[model samples]
Target: MPAPERLLPYWTIAVPPLALTVHFLLHSSAGPAAAAVLVAALLGAVLSAVHHAEVVARRVGEPFGAVLLALAVTVIELGLIVSIMFGGQPEPTLLRDTIHATVVLVLHGVAGLCIVVGAIRHREQDFSTRGAQAYLTVLLPMVALTLVLPNFTTSLPGPYYTATQLAFVSASCLVLWLAFTFVQTVRHREYFLPLPATTADEAPSPAAVAPARPPGRQSLAALALLLLALAAVVLLAKDVSPYLQSLVTKAGAPAALVGVIVAAIVLMPEGMTAVRAAKKNQLQTSINLALGSGVASIGLTVPAVSLVAWWTHTPVALGVTPGGAVLLGLSFLMAILTYGNGRASLLSGVVHLILLATWLFLIVVP
Candidate 1:
């Protein structure tokens, strides 16, 4: 047999199962200590997921690699939302909140952090402008259609689409998603490739990225572990759903915060990976993950959500407040400039971050 790829780290191999075990142990419990353990395990599994995903990404290479990771992460996120929605009381706003949170967090928060970290390390970073443009091209329209259009449509009352409208919107998003995926992975894969860095400073930092995947079994092991990690992450997140609600209530936070927290936890590890890629001067890779996740979150999510909500007779509200619309518009405009510019710097990153902070603050205080 071919030599086994690099032996797997014990933690990467162990965390997912262990987290699942903890989830079973504490899933029904109601208390602080249990919540703490579950949260810790959840985080461990996230890190483990990232490690396995990176290995697979290395094995697969380029935009397809990015697509795999993004799809996996978004699937886990969608699973969490579905499980929670069906497992308990109706949460009509959950889908909207989660999708919105995913877009806002990925587009501004993760992307911003990547630029900041990369710029701080190298002072300048180069990535494929076309790649960024491609992501926004799909993402912007879908956002407007699903998140914004609902508010204005006369076919339904405030903030909803009639079944016909929902069906149309869902189909439209899926088409956009399918077309973008095909383009990114097949027709123009080079758009997502890491551009050749223009300066010596743009080189990968010594510790920025893990070494290449070993040839034989490591990739296979990673693929298996990635699946395991994703399951653990999704289930454990659902198990923690009660705590999120209770925590939000105790804090006197808005109901929407539950979605934000869920999105935050799910995206945190993935965002870290993107930041690391940026620090390595692989800004295109970071962009792929950021925008890819943003697009996939909406494209894949809305369709699945609409179908399920229809079957179960669940209500989904997909409109944003005026403030939310303004923030989203600003965010899109910022994303456009960031992606269109070809060069990334500290200032652009800071701007994106500011938009994120403003959204968060307004949500809390408004």
Candidate 2:
């Protein structure tokens, strides 16, 4: 078997960053725009990771560090994507569809499988059957008001108004997503709920700690280097957006593709972690991280962009297409199914994968 130490390097350095780089390059358009995005994404991903470490360190007592980190990354990722949308090149409906697509994939597809897998492994794990249902409560209304209604508009003033509607919708999304994060991270924080209670006489599980370093200078040096790398990534993303926009225009891909592409990039790190956790039979953590990240992405990104668009008078689309609405409905329903039971199985995993495929089909097709 491969040594755990060897695997650690992959998580800490190799994989998360490698994915970001490839995403930049593959999506880059030829010329200055491509170069700019490459630089910005690289810098952004690094800074984004550092910000994650800072968030984890600051919010130490939060139930899941990984989930919190995923939220943080989504914020940065959305920040870049939304900023790009402001420049001419992206589809008007890109923001709305992207947010919708991300929520579906993360909450239902990734989260559902995590729960199912966890349950299958532990058998005793609780899926919080009732709590999972809350997804339906929130998601249905969100989809209806924002996505579904737009398709039926018969007398809209113009495409400009459609863009304005998207901005408002983005704002709403940001608020909802962030509110959920606050609740999860700060208010209704996770306790050792599923873990068996320890008797007074029993020893507690030992918390993992870092080994002492030789000097404070080394720590500072590491921090500085990390910050520097992060700056580069953001700068790269700035340029990357134009290239991607050009590619989209050139290829005539659907609006939803932007969301999937961005979400996949944002999700790279947490997705790997979730898969690894499932393999280790740590399904609850995986479920929490994956689902939690999806929720956070919605709550946070929508608001952030909404505020910007409102301020700048840039238009964004908030409506979900009929097709997207159906997928969203199914995705939420599945999330309830996967997490409500507090257990998991390969069956649930397959279900989520199906949902993921459905999303891909929706985005790639006309």
Number of the top TM-score candidate:
1
Worst 10 residues of 1 by lDDT: 202-211
What's the true lDDT of residue 71 in model 2? 50
lDDT of each: 0.82, 0.57
Candidate 2, poorest ten consecutive residues by summed lDDT: 206-215
Give the alpha carbon lDDT tens digit for every residue of 1-366 in model 1: 332433467888989889888988888887799999988988888888877887788778765776787677766777668876666645678887887898899888999999999989888888888888998989999999988999999977868888888989999999999899889988998888777656676555543444554565688988888898888888887877777677888899888887787688778876887898887778888888788777888888889889988898877899988888888898888888888879999999999889889889987999
TM-score quality measure for candidate 2: 0.71
| Candidate 1 residue runs with Cα over 4 Å from true position | 1-7, 57-67, 199-216
lDDT of 1: 0.82
Off by over 4 Å in 2: 1-71, 112-126, 129-145, 149-179, 191-194, 197-205, 208-230, 249-252
Put down candidate 2 lDDT per residue, 283-365, tens digits, no spaces. Answer: 54565556655556665666666666678776666666556668777776676666666556667777888878767776676
Candidate 2 residue-wise lDDT at 97: 61
